[model samples]
Target: MKYQFPENFWWGSAASGPQTEGAADVDGRKPSIWDYWYEIEPGRFFNGVGPKNTSNFYYQYKEDIALMKETGHNSFRTSIQWSRLIPDGIGEVNPKAVEFYNNVIDEMLKQGVEPFMNLYHFDMPLSMQEKGGFESREVIEAYVTFAETCFKLFGDRVKYWFTFNEPIVPVEAGYLYDMHYPNVVDFKRAAQVAFGTTLAHAKAVKAYHALNLDGKIGIILNLTPSYPRSQNPADLRAAHIADLFFNRSFLDPVTRGEFPSDLVEILRERDFLPNYEPEDLEIIKENTVDILGVNYYQPRRVKAKENMPHPDAPFMPEHLFDNYEMPFRKMNPYRGWEIYEQAIYDIAINLRDNYGNIPFFISENGMGVEGEERYRNSDGFIEDTYRIEFIESHLKWLHKAIAEGANCHGYHLWTFMDCWSWANAYKNRYGFVEVNLDENYKRTVKASGKWFKTLTSQNGF
Candidate 1:
């Protein structure tokens, strides 16, 4: 009936700058990658809604913070838009953008909600992309300058800082897959992007620590635990490979400061390795994060590939593994993701045993539904008992992990308020409070929001 976290545990939700801020062009804020991508391919976004129609947190941050206090947030996670700060990516810090963030930080501090800020999410300044996004080492230098600026500007009051949020997603989406902007399908380019991102993360960390700011800085990684299809050795090996690629690709370097030898061997075997100077390894080795933020959504159900692809079919991850859904795996009818509660504990235990028990927190986790408002009653509140159940299920495992001496410190949901997703737009609302776009951003706390308030107040549901 009750479980109490450590006293003063962080209690809030995670949000990104592009998803919340709506002042896309005003006050010297230039267009980010999302803005440029949506412009070039208007049909790529959902409901034809672009970044400008985001939750409009730029204008409603005051009211939103009051609502966060009302719903029992002691701390919150949000990202600073890279383009908003440095319109051309590195030069000229926008004064209006600084004022906007200063107001946000002051508001959060006034409401007793410690602000956890991340330097970059998926949004890259379009101008930077024009000059060769993550591939160009010059862009890496630009990122260093931008990260340093953020530390100097906001590091005084903000104690928790993140260098990047889910860096792999952008690499995969933009370089390998075609879902994100600057879409390219070259495996060599993908390798380059991945390597460059790791370097950029280290450079940012190096810069932040050099400032001697009084705070902790880390990176947010989405670690998808891998499960094999069967007990067969081949399936087990396949699952291990999947884990190495999806989880350890970023994890091994960030936490352990070295790439997994097995992964390196595989890359070398396929001739897909990136050009790495010896110093690149040194950068990763010395710049391990102060903390870690693990975002676990679902487990990766994998089996060995049924058949090999042609010689030139390209080196995709799933080429070595196949997603195999177990017959009895629990599924969310409203969504496609498998709902395995134990994965949360498994993730915590993995971090404890292998990652040196680094202090960490859950940066994002939530269920997305196509039509959440269908369950609303006459009072205009969604009966999101499903969301409450989802949180409780994960928390029970988290509480057990903490009691067992895992170094997990806190938990944050996917979002605080509904915001526009990439191509999904507002179709998938994963928030404790729902925002009505038609009503000019009117917010209504869902049933899950009320339950979360009580859970935070009591330290459990």
Candidate 2:
């Protein structure tokens, strides 16, 4: 093997409860924001599909865990839906949800696949959202309670626990971009949501540690390395601001226990800083993460702003920089994302050199194809050679990074099977296993799945 990993490296994939478990309103599971959003605006979803139209993981987890073993999984990560675990997001635990999660965790352990459980995956319970989601400090306390409940219930067997997955997504998508539910476009409000989320994360971390559990807790952040279009001072400044806003905003608080001073100055200058109690800073500073999960998909290529928004326009991150589209850059046509394989290495080196070489992993990385069914061969398997090449190229860069002493320990794909993606629904398939939704959510290992099995068996290609 040309690229062998360290012993006991985690080899698996990740999916979320809202995307995989289809019982949106069954077995005492209440509506999440996804469910509410779909109810009000069904057309917003792809092909009119909603949260209930998922892969049926709630009933098929046993079969899915067996599939994980077949695909060479030594570990797998999935989230516990807050609405399901505590139907209203606070107060009495749902017995059915408990039984379901307990069964899922035990089944994974029985099948030799370690479960890496995340507490939140962009699924805010509707009840919690009604009380202002992360914007309200009260909701933050509620979230802490939910986190503590999960820790008490399943923390014993699930050694890897994450407080939130891509915590910045809700701030950006729901508050600033209007891409998610409770859509609002206010930078000030977005900042508040972001700050509240970080506080919630820190509080949860503090709560977890107070229990003296024998496990690691962390947060999964989707890190996009920012690159300036040129060495010009203006371009460099633009790139720096972009990095500070997108990456360092959460990264610094979680890892370094402080926000970047420059980010603070920028927000302060605009009077956009979120309201924070004096003691909140103490909690944040005292409760940094134990591990980190890096979800790398693309890098941000930025340049100095070519055109500024009108004075009346609402303030936004783009006011500081413009996205640069390099000529002839590699592209994932299906997903409309730049396919920059080297960014993975850039992230590794950044963490290694700047972040004390903290132990981390590629928590979510994979390609999503628009029409994967077109690649199905006569043998009844999707010939997903592109996906295989995609993972291998990134893994080679990761291998080089590891050889250079990066603290990365694992590489889990974005998912283990084709699952529903919010809004996008199942339009882009991103699973090692091909799920035929037309055939009652049937599962078949794709060509990439077979290749992945071999890669894991050899520990590399």
- Best candidate according to TM-score: 2
Which residue window of length 10 is worst by lDDT in model 2?
Answer: 1-10
Q: Supply the TM-score for candidate 2.
A: 0.99
Displacement of the residue 164 alpha carbon in candidate 2, Å: 0.5
lDDT of 1: 0.89
What local lDDT does model 1 show for residue 54? 89
Q: Which residue pairs in candidate 2 collide?
A: none
Error of 1 at 249 (Å): 0.6
Q: 311-351 in candidate 1: lDDT tens per residue?
A: 78877888888989899888876558898888989999999
Report the number of backbone clashes for model 2.
0
